[model samples]
Target: MEVVNRYLETQASMCFSILYDRYAGKIFGKCLVLLKDEALAQDATQEIFTKIFLNLSGFGEKAKFSTWVYSITYNFCIDFLRRRKKMQSLFDDDTEVERLKDVADDVADEELMEMETAHLRAVLDRLPADDRTVLLMKYQDDMSIKDIASMLDKTESAIKMKLKRAKEKAYRFKQEMFTEAVL
Candidate 1:
C-alpha cells in the first residue's frame, strides 16, 4: 500500500487516521482479549497505534501487512504489561472487576457470553503471562503457531507446549469454579 507508506513518510496524521479507522476496533478487540479490561485495552490500543505510526518506516512487505500490524500490537501489549510490573496484565485496576460484576447483575443482559468470557479471562489471568499470551495469540487472534512463535521469539514446539499447558489451566479453573457452585 503506497498510500500507507506515504502516510508514514509524510507524517500525514490524517492518513494515519484512516488507517486507524480501518483497524482500531479489530486491534482493540485483540487488546481486550489480552488485557481483559476495557480501559487498559483501550490505552494499549492507542499506544500500539502510536508505535505503528512511529515505526512504519521499519515495516516491509516481507509478511502480510495485517500480520505485521498484529505482531506490533502483540509486542506492544506485552511490553506494557512487563513495564508495569503487574502480576497480571489483564486489568489495570479493580474498576474492571466492579464493571463486570455489575454487568452480570443486569437481568436483561443479552450477551451472557461477555460474562463467560470475562470469567474465563479471570482464570486466564491467573496463568503465567507467557502462557496466557500464547493461548491468546493462538485462539483469539487465530495466529499460526509459527507466527505466534516468531512474534514471541520462541520455538513453534515451545508455543505448542505453552498452549497445551494454558488449556489445561483454563480447564482446571473451569472445573474448580463449577465444583464450587455445586458444593
Candidate 2:
C-alpha cells in the first residue's frame, strides 16, 4: 500500500504498472457505476489510475487510502458525465452494483431495478455541479450525510435538502421517461 503511494511520488512507470495491477478492476467497477458505458468506463478507469499516479502526492492519507482513491475515481466520472451531458446507459444490474462494492467484481445478483434507479442520470448530469456532486457523494459514494455536508462546506440540513431535491428531479425524469415509453 505504501509502495503504491511511493510509486506515484517517484513517477516510476513500473511502479505505476504495479499500482494498476492492484486497482484496475476496482476503478473500472467504479467507472461503470458512474459512466455506465463499458468502453468509456474502461477508458475512465485507465484515466483515473493515471490521474492518481500523477497526483498521488496530493493524497495525504487524510482518509483511508482506498476512500481517497475512490473519491478521485468518483470525481473523475462525474466530470466525464458533466462534460458529455448525456445518459446513454443504465448501470449494471443491482447485483452488479453490490458486487462492485466487493473487491472481486462478482455479480451474484442479476435482477434489474429500474424503479430503484430511474432515468435521472442524464437529468442529474444537467444539474449544477454543486447539486450533482452532493448526490453522487451521498448516494453513489455512500458518504455519510454529515461527511458530505462537511466536504461540501455546507450544513447537514442543507445537504439533506439538496439530496431531496435531487431525488425529486430524478423521479420527475423517471416519470417523463415512462410517459415517453408508453407513447
Candidate 3:
C-alpha cells in the first residue's frame, strides 16, 4: 500500500520501477503457461506491463496488489488466446449447465499438490487452457474461489465447478502419464 501510494502520489519513475521489478517475472511466468509460446509470452509480458502502468491510478485496493496484477495478467492471456483461436468461450461454458447437473465426484486438492513436480508439470501441459489456468489460479497462485470468480466474471458456484473439473482432469492426466511411463 505504501509503495502504491508513493507511486501514485509522486508519479515517480523509481516507484513504478519498484512495482515492475517485483511483479514482472511472475506475470511473465503466468503468461508463458497460458500462452504456451516463448515469443508470445514475452510480447504479452511487455503489453501487460504497459496496461498495468496505464491503469495504476485505477487500482482501488479492493484486492491485494498482487492479486490485482495477476488478474490483469490472466485476462490479457485469456483475451489473446480467444482472439488468436477465435473461440466462442475459453472456459467452455456451452455445456456448463448440463455438466453441473451431474455432480461428478471431486478430486482431492492434496492429491494433485502432492504429485512429483515433473509429473505435475506434464499433466498441466496436457490440460486445456481453461483447466490449466483455473488450476494455477487456485493452487499455484493461492487465489480464493471468490477472487477467481470475480476475475473470470463468473459466479462463485461456476468457479467451484470449474476448479473441480480442472482438478479431475489433472489427476487423470497424472495417472495416465505415470502409468504409461511404468509400462
Candidate 3 residue-wise lDDT, 61-102, digit = tens: 988999989999999989888988844578767565323323
Better of 1 and 2 by lDDT: 1
On lDDT, the candidate that comes out on top is: 3
Model 1 misplaced stretches (Cα beyond 4 Å): 6-15, 87-119, 179-183
- Which pairs in model 3 have colliding backbones? none
TM-score of model 3 vs. true structure: 0.89
lDDT of 3 at 62: 88
lDDT of each: 0.70, 0.62, 0.85
Off by over 4 Å in 2: 8-18, 87-142, 150-154, 162-183
Q: Give one digit per residue, the lDDT tens place, for model 2 in 106-161.
A: 21111112444444555554544444566567655678888776654568887776
Consecutive 10-residue window with the lowest summed lDDT within model 1: 93-102
lDDT of 1 by residue, 83-174 (tens): 87764543222232211221223222122123377576667767656667776676666789888878887788877756655566565565
Among these predictions, the greatest TM-score belongs to: 3
Ranking by lDDT: 3, 1, 2
Q: What TM-score do all the candidates reach, one by one?
A: 0.70, 0.54, 0.89
